[model samples]
Target: MRFRRLRAIALKELLQIWRDPRSLMIALLMPFTQMFLLGYGVTLDLKHIPVCTFDREASQNSQSLLKHFEASSYFAIARNVRTYPELISAIDRSDCKIAIVVPPDFSERLNDTGTSSVQAILDATDDNTANIAYGYAVAIVSGYSNDVALDALGRQGGELQQIQPVAVQSRVWFNEDLDSRNFIIPGLVAVIMALVGAQLTSLTISREWERGTMELLVSTPVTPSEVMVGKLAPYLALGWIDASFCLIIATLWFGVPFRGTLFTLFATTTLFLTVVLGIGYLLSVLIRSQIGASQVALLLTMLPTTLLSGYVFPIDQMPTIIQDITYLVYSRYYVTIIKAIFLKGAGIAALAVPILFLLVYAAAVMTLAARAFRKRLD
Candidate 1:
């Protein structure tokens, strides 16, 4: 009897899900599109800066300094301006993001004294671009000075003065290359999983109630627990497909590293999906209409997972109270797990805490949902 009821409920849920083309497209295509768009768009790697130079002196030293900028890949001398007005106009018109002004005494000052300074005006409107430009300017000037010092030492044939020197070492733990794709792809998995799990499961269960088929099912020997499990089985399969698609595109198309065991990734994802589906089922029980259930599911899943999940933003940077609240959000732990697994090559031991927290969340939420659903039926 239980087996028959389970089969009937699972078939009904699958049919309803297949009937909706809009929801299906959202589940399948949105993840791939979002990952690719954000991966390419929001990258921090800087390249190809347009700059204008106003050289008043036009001396050998000034020309040599300009040559330094040309040699570096970061800057391309887009325009040569006669006066400060031209440079300012170019910058304001978005023709140049940085401008270098070489004063009239540039060569004289450098020849008379070992130290000389030039004005480097960077457009600070775009913070990331400005920071990259500043670094590029410092690097070019430092390289020029080092070469000059080396040449001067060779001419005099004297001991070189050794200034303060310290070695700085840096190691990027998860992503050594700091590739943005690796970070964004894994985070997309979390968001997509949450969206699909919540929306599909809620709509599936609620539609039956709205159409009065739930009353028919309840009149049979089937218990609410059996009906709930049956409704979830097919959606669980669909969730797995969503997860598999994300993993394939992230690894094959995007060239993201899959450092951890596939088994570990899939197992954790199964647990995560189960929790989301259970929550959706619980929402279906609370709301009487299909529209109300769908709205609640979308709102509850999208905002919390995207904002509080620590996927795009760092949870540590959030206020202390919000950080404490993150304990209840399964995505927060799952994001850490995915990033660690894909980028850091973390093993089960490293992911134990997150796994444990997910298990607790799944169990607690499912139990509550089952109770809530049972009460609604009675």
Candidate 2:
């Protein structure tokens, strides 16, 4: 008999969700759309770059270097300046991201001592862009030096002692190829689960309250736990379907690797959904109106989950207090687990901490939601 009522309620919720095309569209498209926008938008690739040159020397070597900068695909010489003041003024006016100063003794020093230094001033307004520009400038200068010294090296190569420099090799561990899709799809899965589980469940339950169904529900023989589970079961299924779609799309279309056990991933994701759905249920009980519950759920879940969960922004770089706060957010552990399982092939032992956190989050949120429901019904 209880199974019949549970099925009826779940069926009604699914029907309502099906009728709402907006919610259906969001469930389908939001994750992929975010992946496309944020992945392409946050790239490290450099294209046409604005640069200014202050060549006071105007010598053959300086002219040769300037020609190389002009010819390179990475840089466009936006302005030529004879004085430091003009270069500073151009940078201040946002004419160029980088300024190169060639000293008066550039060619003379190179001819006499075989070594010369150039000054590159980078605008620090956008640190990442500035860092890339700085590397490009350094590469251009190093190429110039290499080209000029090739002839000298060729002449003295026979029986000459060579200078060896210390070299550092860097390797990325989890993402060997640095495929942004691997990181992004997992993060999007976390964000999408948060939105669906929290926003939808909260709004649906709040709608029930506004429609005076909660009074009828509490007056029935159904237990609070059963009612709460019944209310969340449909959304939980929806969240699972959304997650499956994301995992398949990312793996098949984008070629994102899934290295860990699929069962482990699903288990962790289920815990995450429970925490998010519980929060939604708690929000619904606290706020009597659908709009208020929806707003509160969105505010509590969406922004922080996306921003502070190390989805796009690395948590290591965030403020310490904010990092401390992320511990309480279910999505934080979800992002960690998904990224680890997908990218790092991390097993249960490797993911124990995040798994524990997710379980604890689910338990806490579920307890709170049950209490909220009891209070509201009484």
Candidate 3:
């Protein structure tokens, strides 16, 4: 009998949600759109860095070295300069990110002393890109040097077996291709859900107050607990649908791997939705103004979820106080769970701490929201 009442309230809420086209659009389409924008728009991979060369040698060996740089997909030779000043000008003008300076005695010294040196100058304004480009340049030069050394030893009647070195083989686990999208798309699940879940419920009760319908509902036979459950039900279903869309897009469109079972994914998403929805409900009950509730919800959910939740940045690298404050951000646990499931194939046993934290967070926020609702009624 009591279940029938809850069902009626839930149905009414669903009807109301349907009546508002904007709300319906938000619930049905916003998450997928947001994920698409963020997933494809942002990237960290560096490629095709422009390079300038100052080749004083004009020799066969110097030209050979330049050919190696030109052959690599990582670098594009933008200009060949005659002077050091011209090389500096190319980098300063943003025409190139890397500059290679080959000395005049390059081939002569290499043939005579079995050694040669070249200088690589890099633009350090963007440190991460600079570092990666430097590494690529170093690797290319090192490989060329090794080949030259091997050829020189062969001409000296040395055997290939006496080249003298260890060959190392490396195997990357989990994400072998090392695609940044693999790491990024999974964390986006938590971020998108945090925004969608909170934004949906943030306006619910507050909109009732704005439209003068709350007093009517309060005067009816429907209990505050029933109203709360009804308000949460439709949005919870929407949240699950949004989460499923995110998972599908992450896997099919973005090519992110999902190594965990659907059961674990659904369970973690439910716990996360509960916490975010409770926060929105509590805000709605306390603020009673739809505009204020929406603003507060945006502030609470979106910024922290993207920034502090380790979705884009590592929380461990943050200062001690900031790291401590991140414990309060519920999306942190969800991001951890989502990434682990998508990347590591972590089970419930491996993710017990985050799961426990989400449980506690859901319980605490929902209890607070219930208390706030009752107080508002009084």
Candidate 4:
């Protein structure tokens, strides 16, 4: 609590961080590395899907149908085959994700019977990709079908009449372009902060034990509160630096829209960083070995934050039991809060619930970390 003692402890910790090459690399370079890697490397939007074409009739109608797939941005015609075995070979060689096949009677059926089916062969290895490809293919075919019907009507009788009982209009809010980066980058803030903060603070007291400086630390007149706060102060500043770096990269470099105010972003980041630092410090106090403390901190912070915080996967899609367990993961609240702030531009009033949970979590972990450390060598 005394400023002089606290300042001395903080200065010592900062000096240690400055002198250690590993700590400097982690604090200075790791944020940029992780942000670029996770931001650009991860995405959900699939485009330029490889497709193979097999036209049995080789008619103008079949050529026209193939043209539709070729024109679509989602489908790229990678191979054209005449025989079924060749089509199968192309698929087996992974030349394509979807195969477009026009039946021999496709044109005849459409001309005479006013109906024809185009077969879509999918590689179901990646079911999600396959499903999306199938949806795209269906949409293209539906549009083509409408075009064909209109042409036939115009030739047979007159102009086609358009009538609709209901028209559905959709307005996309927040992520207008449906860019995954907007949401993913915000969650990355939580992940990166948790990882960097915990990894750094977890080494502080444990480094003292490893270097035989515990006696010096114990003999100091500073209380446990002063030592803990002093040790965490430097890391808290590093955490802020990393957070600001991530926000800048997310908004400027990656073009992820940051709709939230600066105050909301930094305020929540501080609370989240406190929880991360406390967890690391608690582990460092409990486990005296530096390597052991660092590993334990990774296990406690990184894994849970990535897996349980809805970073890449949707929580509702998870098993009911797993979804329930996510409530205990503090990063989940921070992730949700940051995403809301970034995407929805949510204010403090709208974010009260998650912020309250995060505040309680920060207070609880700091309490445990403070109590876990003692002045004696037991």
Candidate 5:
């Protein structure tokens, strides 16, 4: 309640942070290191997938189909196989993820029955990659079939409209280019905020105990509320700084889109930081060992954020039980809010539900953390 005492305690803690080299390294270097590492290292986009082919006919039609795969940005033709064993060996050696086989009667079937099939073999070890590659192959083959159909129709002197199917007009919004980085950077920002805020603040009260200063702190006239606020204020500011750094790197360096207002970003981020900082401070007050507190804080913040928060995986695709459990992880709400704000240009009104959840979470955590800290050494 006393501003003077709170200011003095805050200054003392800030001075302690300045003096501790490990704290300085954590507070300064961790953000930069995490941003670059996760931003570039983690991704879902697959490009230039290796492909091997076996053309049974060695005919012009088969060669043309092979050219279609080569021209695609998603596939690179690595080998032209003479036999089925060669195709299998290429996949076994991991030289190619996909294999294409042009049938011997491919052109004859097309001409006689107006239909033909090309065999596609896939290495299904990584099923997700295999599925994506299969879809790409299907699209390329479908286009080639359509081209052949049109050419046959022209040769027969028939109008294109007679064989034409309905065309689909698709549109993409938010992340128009379908760049994963656009959404990923925002999720990274949320993770960094939770991680750095908790990890840094976890050491605050625990450090006081380890340095033999708990006695002095107990003897002071400062109320528990004042001590808690003073100890956490510096970290709250630091959370914002870390947030700013992440935003700058994401928008400028990595070129992630920023579609929302600054007010929406700051408001949600502050609520998120309060929740994480409270969790860390509570850990610090309960656990006297600085190392123990820090480790527990890291486990609490990082695991749920990365795993259950729909960061790298889709929550809908997870098991029903896991999807229900994700509701309890605080980072899930923040991740959803952040992605919406970054990609959809959402505002406070649009994000009322998640922001409300965050506000309640912050209040509950602060209540527990503020009451957890007492001047008594016991």
Candidate 6:
């Protein structure tokens, strides 16, 4: 039977893959290891941000305000300085991320004028962290001020019973907790897939050439299409298995929500693997050298997936030329699709453009890889 021959070739390739310990590691262990390291290591949540304070007044009110900053889980008061110069030294030495300067008249001014001012100096070397810390400080200060106002009003004939102003309530959609991991883990799937799929196949056909097995394979009854399919089958199955492991780790271990259907996830992953594997096969056939194929695969697949796929950075903020170039990166489309499925619970209709692009890319690359493979055999 035709199926029997194809199965035999697939099993042979699988055996070859199994005999190579490094390939087994890459196929089985690499994805989960990368996911674990990246998931736990990469984070945007700012916590325990060190701060130094200079309380010139050293009054009850100023102390009360300082206590709030120290109480917050977001901030930690590293040291209390006596002078502005000491505060500056802490920031300059990277001992603190923020510096609080409570004016000498802080308590007196608040008691007399019902208001007081405090200055916060931030180290902006890490601008994103600085901005987030600043926001946290503002929110704490605002809540303390509101408490002070309420206390004052309560003492004054219970003015709190009078008409209250409108209050604004904020609601966050999708990632309701605003967890950075929720956004990051989904995009990482694309990057890991690119690295694993491309690197694995990048050496496959090249290894055949290097081992001088191409001549033997060429003389077989297997057609080029059959050969390509048989070669791709085991790796494709491995890719899916790796993807499943990633999904499990992301959702259960990392606690990232999976909002889309399993069918959609599997479908998109299949299309993406097709694109990357085709690219790897094409490079392997053309170069006929494992080292060259690997370098080219890393350059084309891994680098682009990491940088241009909008995985770690925002594509919109990039230059127009760079953004235009990203359109050609298949990982870009897959990243969008994965993120939407993970975060937005997007259905097929919602992600038609990206799906279409992935389809076109897979078709084009597979066709080209087939041609290159046949020519190389001849």
The estimated TM-scores of all candidates read: 0.87, 0.84, 0.93, 0.96, 0.96, 0.94
Q: Point out the worst 10-residue segment of candidate 6 by lDDT.
A: 369-378
lDDT per residue (tens digit) for residues 251-351 in model 2: 88768888988888888889999998898888988897988998999999998888888887888898899989887667888899999999888888899
Per-residue lDDT of model 1, residues 220-299, tens digit only: 77777877788889888988888888888888988889899888888888988989898888888888677888789888
Residues 205-273, candidate 6: write the lDDT tens digits. Answer: 999899999888877777766777778888899999989999999999999999999899999999999
Give the number of the best model, judged by lDDT: 4
What's model 3's overall lDDT?
Answer: 0.89
Candidate 4: list runs displaced more than 4 Å: 165-167
Task: List the global CA lDDT of all models.
Answer: 0.82, 0.82, 0.89, 0.92, 0.90, 0.90
**How high a TM-score does candidate 5 get?**
0.96
Q: In candidate 5, what residue range of length 10 has the lowest lDDT sum?
A: 156-165
- In terms of lDDT, the poorest run of 10 residues in model 3 is 369-378
The Cα error of candidate 3 at residue 171, in Å, is: 2.7
Give per-residue CA lDDT, model 3, range 1-378, as digits (tens). Answer: 267778988898899899999888888888778888999886666768899989999988899899999999889999999998898889989999999999999988897898889999999999989999999999999989988988877877756666567978899888888777888889998988888888879989999989988877777677677778888999999999998999899999988999998889999899999999999988999899988998999999999999999987889999999999999999999999999999889988999999999999999998888877752356
Candidate 5 collision pairs: none
Q: How far off is residue 9 in model 3, in Å?
A: 2.1
What does candidate 6 score in Cα RMSD to the true structure? 1.9
Q: Report the poorest 10 consecutive residues by lDDT, candidate 4.
A: 159-168
**TM accuracy, model 3:** 0.93
